[model samples]
Target chain A: MTTTEAPAPVRTAPGGPPAAVRAVRRWGFLLRRLGFYAAAAAAAIVLNFLLPRLMPGDPSSAIVEELQRVSGQQVPPETLESIRAIFGDPDQNLGEQFLAYLGQLARFDLGVSVVNFPVPVSELVLQALPWTLLLVGTTTVLAFVLGTGLGVIAGWKAGSRLDSILTPLTAFLSSVPYFWVALLALWVFGFVLGWFPLSGGYDANLAEGFNLPFLASVMHYGALPAATIVFSAFGGWLLGMRNMTVTTVREDYVLLAQAKGLSRGRVILRYAARNAMLPSFTGFAMALGGVIGGALLTETVFSYPGIGYLLFESLNKRDYPMMQGVFLIVTLATLLANLLADSLYVVLDPRIREQG
Target chain B: MVTQIMSDTDHDDAGTTAARGADGDVLRVTGLTVEYVTDGDPVRACADVTFTLRRGEILGVAGESGSGKSTLITALTRLQRPPAVTTAGSIVFQPRDGGAAVDLVTASPRALRALRWTSLSIVLQSAMDALNPVMRLGAQFADALRTHDRSLGNDAAWARAAELLATVGISGDRARSYPHELSGGMRQRASIALALACGPELVVMDEPTTAVDVVMQRQILAQVLRLRRTLGFAVVFVTHDLSLLLELADRIAIMYAGRIVELGTASELYDDPRHPYTRGLRDSFPPLRAPLRRLTGIPGTPPDLRRPPSGCPFHPRCAARFEGCDTHLPELVTKGGHAVACRLHDPTQRPQPAPGTSTGGAR
Candidate 1:
């Protein structure tokens, strides 16, 4: 029988560069990605201007009708004319209005919140954003860490007692509506149990200062809402991470790690869990985008002055400017979160680094 | 079973001496049977398979994809999963410490884990999935060494890993490279070096060179051969290519339907195959002596082991069929050192009427 002989080794092309140069190149790649995001943001602004024109009614006329209904009396012809003069010319073409809207956006003048009487939409949104971030951001991070850790354990020991117990429970929780769970938590933790405050940002009698009691009162009022968010959202994280971990545990690299005789814990944690966590990281990043939205019903039910509650109030009173501002911020946040997730894919998985 | 030949000591006795011969018999397996429960039915993957390997010997076990060759090697390492039951077997691994033969099939989980990479290790089939995409080659090697020997610090582990990579013909710098950065051949070599990090006595390779191109396959084979010579580790090389096996293996075992139909020295098996199935296999392989020669593929696929034929697994494919071949099963009988299970080779066995002829006079 004839045998094939070993082939001559092909000489590798010479490489030139130190670690510092490679680091700079990687940063350059990141900047190019940021450039794409800036382009998307510009397109979003243009769409915002064009979208209002597509609507059937004239926004200025709608405002006049709303003012008359709220006052419960028809305004005199002179006052109506004055109102029209300040708002805009009623007979102006839609093209002019659209161009004027674009001009306003260029100056960051989103206009006033009609429901709030005199507050600018941007100012109102900014006041509410920090509360939403505190409530949602903290809960999201906590859920992600707890859920991902449990998921890794469940997947590594799949079909064991731990998986048998956690899988069905998390699946049940995932199917339960978030609003229903929030309501239940409010009833149990807030009203019936009386362990936490029922509503508002802080205890009514607490002094507004950077003191321990004031901070404690703020945390107490925030507890039930935060718990509602965490409990309702944790199931999704757990189920998602568990599923991903199960898939990653079966990967050949994990088997190779086992073959290498690495400690069981190291194999599970480093090889299996780390790879399995990739999909969960994307989910977490997407959740981070929704932090600005918070939990609308929960926030409203608890009277928390977060962005979700403010957005709810704005929608009720037809506060178009405030609603638009909140929508733009939420949309931008979502897009940014997605972009971050994509960039992280390159960091977590080397296969994407070169291709990306 | 202690053999007289294995009892005598030599300078090569750096490990187990169960199957040690002057020619280097390092591992011996006998009566190995592996069955798996599939859909609540026990499917026999390997049945009564047996073979031996000398130090520095590559014993190629040739078969089609499902012929249980891969299953056999996996069973040798106890890597087979649940439902794939290793029902009955004795994989006597000759240890490197010159200790008594250890039965791999019956070893405890702890014992098996300890023996892995230190005494017997496996090089898996797929190179793409073998190395962790997240970890660098050096880290992976260090992980292997650190697993077995905890005293190895990070610096020491990395140094040892670099040395192992260098031994496998890879540069020390390549150790820092992640698996994705390396080529397919490089990945396979890195995997091989990882397997050999502890300098195991026997390395069980399952389709180790199949993933690479033909040229790369040769390079990997040559590297394995060179390492075997320098380290004196035995190998149980499993592959589907008989021609490659003929070149690489000192002895070869031909498996058919989960059983070893023929086992002999590579040259002897190639020159004169006693079993009809072995003959068919030898004839089917593309003849290298004549480049223009048409390769003949075997006529039928291997029989399903779940519902194997009663008399002989190879009866349907065998060219020489006789009466009683359908009624009696052949037992593996020894002729000198070689073993074959064919009724035609028996002295008392009588030839029956040829096919399509009357059986009145022959009976």
Candidate 2:
């Protein structure tokens, strides 16, 4: 029985903008995000150039001392000059050399490592990257999925024993550092039990190939370090998400969802969990971008052939070019992660998009 | 009760308002009480409230903030959760299609779920936050329908949602828009549409237009009244705005403290109010059509439910309070046909004049 009454006043017109204007606004929003990232990336590159200079020791002198240690003779001045050129000119002022380095960076050249002699810094970084990505990346993803899933259940059923027990237990685990946990795992499962290998990325007999046997051994040797990373990181995600979900459950929209006669499961998933998980998603994205950096001490304790372990080796030998290479990768990775999170937040919350 | 309500009909403004719909009671709430068990002490939010909703009748619940109108509505719907506990009461809700009456106070979750959005639905206080911001308005409507009736497929559910949106005068194309995309007025209308999607026999709205502009508020109420006429559903509309209720409600109930002190037909309550609290409520709203008059607010704070006063809850503010009013608890008793819970109307009792005779029509 619909009546032909006067039409309802369109107080706020339904559509806000024309299709073409809206499209332009969307593109402008994307450009703003990218612009922010571009500025941050430049700052990070400048910081990378200045950080090594902050160190007390000279970059070239370390190379000379190492040469003396290997050959049991003091290196000649001519030899030192040649070696300095390979790293970068030690004679030039810091400003000129920085300009030279920036020019070389633009050309995608990281120069030869002072310690590795003829090996390009790029080659050393590339060789160490896959190990870090495979180990740290897999563990981070596993922890996020597992932790967020458990957190959703725990927060929804907050007063239950599972919530009471899991919240504290995760808190305690998260307080301990990754390396300390790795060492503890080694003590219990490696040293005391002798159930797994103590060090290295793979079995000595296995060649580094994509063959099934070699890959299986790589995972086998990588297990302890991966577990250590996951064990420590998952707790933060779990706790953060648990608190978020608990707060989100009280939101009016979630209550509205329940009033709609939706099952508790759907209300928690669609309303509570989705909103709660936004902050956690940023953490996950950052972790993903830093995947190439690897868990530093976890890799060191296991002597795995990851970037973290390689950084440790380079640090000891005073490998200047290699250090710059790895630091630059880390800087770029962090900047990219921040950019990803910015875009991600806009997508997750339309309210933010409107404000922007 | 009939005798008590009828006594005040001499001054009743218009005759044919809510009195015509006093037939079969669709809901009977007897001795319904709800309390908040907070840390410091238990606060009685709504106490011993009793009312009946006739089929297709509109009931307006009026009170100031902290007066428990919202609590009573939430409790009636079995939506009160801890720490707001339903301490004592029985709410008998009968399905319009003639199923056995269900006690909402003791109904199982499954039973409540089945009743919500199908037999009875609610339009919450704030429409802005009541909607799922991430989902499209149509998607939310479809979700409500589909969740209740799983046999309906996605396409059918969507079509039903579009139709419901149209019923509220919102275009079908706006279905894809999110809540934030719509203005405040449209969002409120969308919430109304969501409540009506299932064709509920009763709809409970808690201050639905409080956040809108004054002009939009009147427009929304007009739209709602028109819809109710065609759809034939009962309403329990709660607001702190008594003027809005006078224009919109069929029956108006004035609450003081946690208890409803006066309940009558709109004209009887407006023109022949007997309870001091109801008079205070009526005087607070300036009559738009009447000549401009000085308006003074109710003088004192409402009794704290945690430690309520010994006698009549409104004695501290009651202009016509008597000696016995400070010591004797007044029961809601019928004087003629109107119901007033004030000591002035306590029959067999005080020789004090009721507000109708004592205060005249206007104090």
Candidate 3:
């Protein structure tokens, strides 16, 4: 028998040259994804316009009646007519009003808050935005990194004493309801021990100057709320990351890495941990959108000047403008967060980019 | 009974030299028994299995899915978990520097870790799941090399990895590509390259080509043979295909119901199988040259190892069974370098023909 020196390379259907062809394919795919996002955003905006109309009561009449109840005085007919004209007469044609609302959205003018007297919805929302960002954003990022690191250690040494200790603790913490945990924390840290202030945004005694003392008081006031946010949310991240790491450890690639004689630490971190992070990464992005809207009940309980507290107040006062403003911001933020995640998918996994 | 026939044959070659060619045996496994404690019952997966693999030779272990072929290889590497127990047996590996052979079965975890990759390695089945999609291939390779050898610099580690990739028929440039960027064949080749990065003396491959296309399978097999020639490492090749083994392996062992029924040179097992199970496997593969011929499957499924037959495990599926076949288990007997486990060839035991057939019809 004759043994050939080299075998011929396998060939398949022509798909053009590799480099230039793959680049063009990638851009084409990204364009398609962008188109899908644009379509979805348009649909959401349309739904936003239609939603308020479907509400049971007339928003204009509700605003007027609420104002009268607060003032405890009879308003002149001329003044009431002027308020109606400015807010949009309830009797106007639905199609014309819808067109007018769309025009206002295009110009970035969400109009005024009907519930909060004389306060523009945009100004109120912006004021609350920074607080939520500082509280939840910092905690979420910290939780992701710390939880993932711990999870890698736990999963790699699975069935050992460390894993045995951590697994059940994380499970218990994850099962505890966030609100229940917050209430318990408030009772202990606030009412019982008096280590932290029970409620409110900043210390009432601090002067309105950008001084070190004022900043310190602000941080002091933030301590309880920030702790509550981290305590309630940290468990979810830890449990998610730990479970994912366990599953990733069983994957064939991880076994292959171990068989390659990679050091135990390197195998756990570079191979197992990175792959395990994929599922948790997507979850974290979704959580980012929710965080922007802030924790509604938590903020209400604390009397914090975050978007959630603002939304609660606006709902109680029948503040239509403030409510519409907050909802629009939330919708946009969620869509943008999802868009960021999809783009991240391309960066983290080149296969998605190549498949384009 | 078969032992008598073997001793009779051994007497004819008493003066042959055995020592000069004996040093090349890299791994020798004898009487290996493995069982699993399943739902409070011990299920035997391997029993009294014996085989030897020499350096620079490929030994193919052929069997169906439930034949305990994978368990045998996994046991050799000490990769089996708790429920699966290695009850008895010794897996001895002859060191490359002529040191004392180490028994793998009883080695400590630390000793096993040190011996792995440099002395022994394994290649798994699926290429897709056998690579970290998030990491660049170069970093993955360097991670493996860095584990055992700390003296090598970053550049040198990468250089060595690229060289190893070339050895597996992949280009050095492909080292920078992630696993997902590579084709299925390329990914398998990369995995094989990683297995050989530390220059292991023995590599256990379990169905490495099972997931690839037919053409890619042949390419991979050819590449493996070529690497074996250059590296001179011993291999324990496990697969379900007997025909492919004919071209790649020097020796072949057939397993049935968690036991080695026959062991011989590739040619001997293919041309003159003595065990009924081996004969069935041989008859099942269609001749390569006759493409249109119908492939014949074995008549019955393998016995469930949890509650195996009393005597020979293959007796239920064997066409050559006689009256007393169910009463006794046969010991493996060596004859002219081939080992077979059967009772018909002994002079001490009465040679009763099978119930419905004559001796001539059996052959």
Candidate 4:
């Protein structure tokens, strides 16, 4: 490189403040994206406000009626109005109610739940959040890691025995619905073999603090349900990643890496797999976001105490506030996950970087 | 000197060896044949191709697509993978340090590993695709350096990479940017810089300038020549464009249907090509400074190597084909450092196409 004579050279000068310009453009891109997400969030909240009214029954009315029947006394009309207000009155003018709902949202008050009267919807979501995060979140990540790793190998060695066996196996497993997977695992492991407990997030015998026994019980009982969701979703990640890896293997960079005399391992790791893993990384982030909503069927089958189980219970009781609260959380979390992935992808792929 | 004789197959005892660097021949390729084994018959991508790349010389390979220009380079570097089998020939590389000539066709994996990047390297065609997208330019350069020389520190490797980039007239922190951040010309130049990172004695380039614009291409070629003069490394440049080669190359090899039809010094082949295919190829490039001659595209497609025409492979498209051209094959005959495989230049052949006649009245 030092040998060039520089004869007849036409040197283009580096422009001033190009770096600063690039940074400004990147920041602009981020601001624009934030604005777009804000609109999405607003739309989602408005939908959340309207969706609870469409539920078949009302939680406040059911609770009030049950109370009156049990006590053998009619509830006062003023008290009835206050109970209705707590769960949102569907009879109110739609436009005015939406504005009022937005006003209440601004104050960080999600209103008290009628089903669990006097308990705020926010506290309910908070209580269930960690369990869902632990069970579903961990499983989703495990599935992605296991699937993507296998996928890289399969795609790298497309016609090998590993690919031939795993491709169809994973494809078949992917077709099994969540309920079926949970039910089948429950029947075999819990009922037939009795090697695992049938249902519940923790052992009925243990106390509910942070002791080792209770923690062990949570995982022990959570295992079957988690496996159901993870195994069912695992195959899709594997197939998607395998297909991506196969395509990426043919990319010119992989060939270039080989031409540079890098070892096969370096070529596969640095060139083939790194590029192939981009789509999988984005998929994993999106999955993580959505998993916050909880795996409904798996949770329901296992009677697990996650957000999905709470959603099911609230829906069964026609608990409008609880349903609305859970739905809003799910929507917001999913949106946030997608946005984070998009930003990270921009970081990973320079082709889309700093091009505001 | 155990004189190397390249027979029909690449695996035939690798022929022989000699004091290869004595006459400045950095690479001696003889009877190299690479075949693609399809379901039916094996297609010959490169067939019995023989040539020598001298020290510090730019040997340009000019041919249309499917003319085996790329395959020839792939064979020379042992980069040909399965389905594209090297059926014949030997590529004898004379080590720059005056060590015994190593036959690349027979070099063990460990030996090849050690020799690569140090003595031999390659620049792929597409600059954008050549660099790893996920990796920063500095890291990619570091990767190339660390692969062969593991003892080199990161800072040293990065400094060397930055130095290389500077020689290509890129004097900035652009090495820290990804391939996409750099312009096409810059990326190509970076690739060139990487090829020179280990100070290889010979660099094989597969259309290095084809991906960049014409202006950039000229600049890169000029830089390559100047670099070659200073670094004293031989280059085997392959491209479909002949005009660039005519201007930049010291010597040229014209391939037709997997075979080198003519090999000569750049000016000799440009002015007085004896092979009809070579003449057609030369005419195809619209001469820039000379009198304006209408550019005539070659009349026919390249012959299918799976079932190639017998005798002379270029006979179907040759404008000056004699009767013997369709019946007898002509071996490359050397005269005054120029070689042409055609009856017109074959002193032993009789009744050649009548002198000055327009090829059997075909016009």
Candidate 5:
């Protein structure tokens, strides 16, 4: 029915400002996101400073006791004093100790490792970081890419036999403990089949370089652990992506895309999978952050020289400084990854850019 | 087959009327039955529905909620998802290129894709949800444009996209913005522009203006009318608002349950509704110019398609019930320009018009 009221004026400008001002407004969201990440990192650093101090036992005495147990010789008082200074002076107030800790962090001086007396905690961490990053990081990216691709297909043809087979299979694989799968993979591929090295990151006797033999040996050592991680981890990505793709496929935009006469591939990939992958990005970022810590149980089982193994060794040795260094690194890495995800999301979803 | 009601006198444009009379059968849906296959039994959502759309014609399908209006739209476009399947009938769409008419129900996936955008497109209800939130408006338009024409360069396609936006009164620069950037009304208009990107012959709209405010609704409908005048695409607009259809559509089909109960020219349905249900719907809306009156909504909710009422589906709610009303189903019988499915209008049952004799049904 015709109305007496005149039609309202159309929204000509999306914003009130002219082009230059509007262009400046676009960067406001990114600046705000950076501010959030910086705040989170500050909070994480404060917590890192406070945690070890709050623990009951002094790390110095623990080191002294361990030294006596190992050598059967009484440790000197000066040694204890030096260890206390290296850890954090028990004499100073929490405020002064916190300031000192921050200073050390700023200088990248994480103190000496208790397990290997004069070796710096940062040096130990640096040595182990690359192995874990190469192993777990590569596997995580591989699993995500392959799993998401299969998921898009499976979800697009949800009722087909391919979907029918993969859906239950992934459901089962993802639910089983990955460590158990790692053990099984070790028994089958390493122990029984003798195809891969049973333990370690690379051949101990190989001359370390970017040479062909060393790289091949590294791959040879990494293959069993990588396969096990991918086998167990891929299922989760596939299931998450499949579920999301199934839901996204039902979205009005996806339906409209189909109605637009787009090819089936276009509908599945650009329309369905593109939106579906948004939720998975957060998960993938967290997984990337965990890559810095490495897959703990899998690393222990493989006897790989990674951050996870180093942390496990530090825990057994009661090496507080090493553990604290690893924890700080892990926390910072997680924050950085989350920041990356948020920025990536702004690129992927334009709605986020408008909220600011 | 239900009778095709093309009221030559109802059209204001002489050129359109002449073109329709020459060769206007763009879409002929014959006995199109759609059913939802549930666990217990298959529920018939659209049972034996038949209608024909002429070139450049606007056929408005008006019904209450759960009246299978949406179901018919999806079925006609062959966009029905799982559980809902077209078990019978054919949607014989004749392309404007003078190609052979192809039945959509039996068409291959490749054939369906070819028809989309170029020959037949859809403008869905919620523009916010219908547009790709991640993609820019211009990119989505370019996608459809480049897809149909492989020879179109990327820059040219984008230029064409901006031009399409301009048709809907959206500025060329706004096409760079995302769907969320534009207001609700603008997004709906953008979707309309997208649907007309390939110059489709038939545009199936399912309550395209339901989500917007009254002012925006009027603006969008007005824009649709303006565009249809120039592009000349047939629209099958489905909505629950009969009064809106009375103003917009050339021919209005009123659906009750899962079937078209009455269909006629907009004026014919308004001035003299043949079926009792259509009369109830017409009276439900408050007249724009008339004095104040109590609105009389049709009694009883729509029947459940899972276990629909026997005989005439509307008989249980009928104000003019007589012998054989509950026992026998009525067929859609056309008298002059109007077609109605009711025992009261069935000449075979009544033999003659009964005046002031049996029931309290309003004339």
Candidate 6:
């Protein structure tokens, strides 16, 4: 029994703009976000250029000292000058040096790695970058999904057996140091059991391509390191999500949803978990940005040929160009990840869209 | 024992405006009791609440903060959460489609799920919180509508949602707005509209207009009355404000501590309240248009439910308490159209009063 008569309409604000026009307003918000990211990137780039130059001691001598320790070889004067040339002359006017740095950056020329002499810093970065991104990026996402899903179940049934088991177990696991866990995993699974590869990103003999054999080999070798990282990381997400879900489930809207006669699954997922995931979503974005820096100790323990391993080696040998290049990539990746988070938030919460 | 109050003729007369179908009663709640089970003693929040709501009647439950009015509502709606359990009760609901009446207290979860929204719905207080802040108004409505009847496609569900919004005087287009986007008054109205989405026969409203301004409260009450007129749904309105209920409720039930001390027609309760507690409540609200009089609000706080007072729960605060009142619990005694749970009106407590000599009401 529905009424057909027209209702007396209340307070029409000239009917809000059509969908297309509203969509453009959202773009205005996105454009503002873009402007913020651009300025942040510019600031980071300037710091990338200035930080190495402002470092104590000559870059060439630091390399020479490391080289002598490694190879027991003395660098000739000519070789020293060539190394200094790669560093763009420490005494050059600050403006001129900055311009030269910007010009080199524009062409993606990060100069040459001192330790891997004659090899470009960009090339070394590119080689290590993919390994780090693939391993760490995929594991981060997997941990987030698995953790959040479990958290929803645990929090929804807070006093049940599953909740009791998961809560304390994850809490203890997350509190343990990451490197300690990684080392333990390596020793137990790799050294003792011999169930997985002890070190490296993939089998060295397999050609690195899109083929299934190569991909399988990579995963096989990457498994222990990936598992360790995920194990240590997922706990934090689970605990955070569990706490948030506990609070969100008590919200009046969730109760209202239940009273609406919606299914339990719908109440948990759409009404409870959806809102609870907001803070966790932001944390996940930050974790993703950290992935570019690589799982340092995990990679070191595995000798995984990722960015973290490369960074460690470069630092040990005082490879200034390689260090500079890696730092810049980390900074840029963090900024981009934050930008992605801001954009995704607009999609997830309509409240943010209005502000944007 | 639970007391079934209200004269049959008066109840039928008050409810006749929109009563339909063969059976006059839509809900029959008998010996309904609710308790808060804590670490220590379990506190009885509602003790032996018995009342029958007729089709298309507004039964207003009025009480102070701790008087179990809200508990009674939650128990009726079967929405009481952990620690608050319906220990004993039978919420017998007769469905609109002439189906068998089901006792909600023992209804299976699957059965309750089927009955919810279709036969029973609730409009909660604090509309800002009751409606999901993140979801668009239409989507929430669509969710409720589609879940009950799977035949309606997404488009059809959305169209119905817009129609529901329209009935509340919210433009159909405004259904796209989130709960946070609407004015407080509008959000409450939207919640009211959402409750009516499935055309529920009974709507249990728990202080639905408490969060809005006075003007909005009046508008919302007027809207509720208007909607009930067309839709013919019964309402059990629970609030602390008796004055508001006087204007809205066909019948008012005044609760003291955990028991309903008096239940009668609004005019009867207001003009000639039989129970001392009900009189205290009526005197608490100064008449709006009438000249101001010194208000003698209730003297004492409601007793702690964990260790309630012996005998009559209201005797400690009651001015008219006699010797037997503190020693023995009083049953809600009905005489004519009014019912009062007081020894003063208990016919067995004293020699039977001659006809028309009672303290309140014309017999």
Residues B53-134 of candidate 1 have per-residue lDDT tens digits of 7766777898777899988977888777676888875776666567666667777677678778888777999888988888
- CAPRI classification of candidate 3: acceptable
Compared to the true structure, candidate 2 yields what TM-score? 0.88
Question: On a 0 to 100 scale, what is the lDDT of residue A111 in model 2?
Answer: 59
User: How do the residues B1-363 of candidate 4 rate in per-residue lDDT, one tens digit apiece?
Assistant: 323333334323221122243457788887888999989989999888888788898999998899999888888888876678899777888776767777888877777777788889999999888899879898988888998898999999898888999999886477777776677898899999989988999999999998888999999999999999899999999998988999989889998888888888899887887777877888777788889887676788998888899899898887777677788988876776788888876667846437556443211
Quote each prediction's TM-score. 0.85, 0.88, 0.84, 0.89, 0.91, 0.90
Candidates in order have lDDT scores of: 0.76, 0.79, 0.76, 0.81, 0.84, 0.83
Native interface contacts kept by each candidate, as a fraction:
0.51, 0.50, 0.56, 0.50, 0.69, 0.54
Q: Measured by TM-score, how close is model 6 to the native structure?
A: 0.90
Error of 3 at A51 (Å): 5.3
Docking quality band of candidate 6, CAPRI definitions? acceptable
Q: Indicate the DockQ of the complex predicted as candidate 2.
A: 0.37
Which residue window of length 10 is worst by lDDT in model 4 chain A? A8-17
Off by over 4 Å in 5: A1-26, A51-86, A90-99, B1-22, B290-294, B351-362
Q: At residue B256, what lDDT does model 1 achieve?
A: 85
lDDT of 5 at A303: 95
Of 2 and 4, which scores higher on TM-score?
A: 4
**Model 1 ranges with Cα > 4 A deviation:** A1-29, A49-110, A208-210, B1-25, B99-101, B290-295, B350-363
Q: Model 1 chain B, poorest ten-residue lDDT window?
A: B9-18
Residue by residue across B46-140, what tens digits does model 2's lDDT show?
98888778888899999989899989878877777678999986777777765767778878788888888887888888998888778778789
lDDT of 2 by residue, A211-262 (tens): 9999899888988888888888889889989999998887778877877888
The candidate maximizing lDDT is 5
Question: Candidate 1 iRMS, in Å?
Answer: 3.5
The true-versus-predicted C-alpha distance at residue A317 of model 1, in Å, is: 1.8
| Candidate 6: C-alpha RMSD after superposition | 6.6
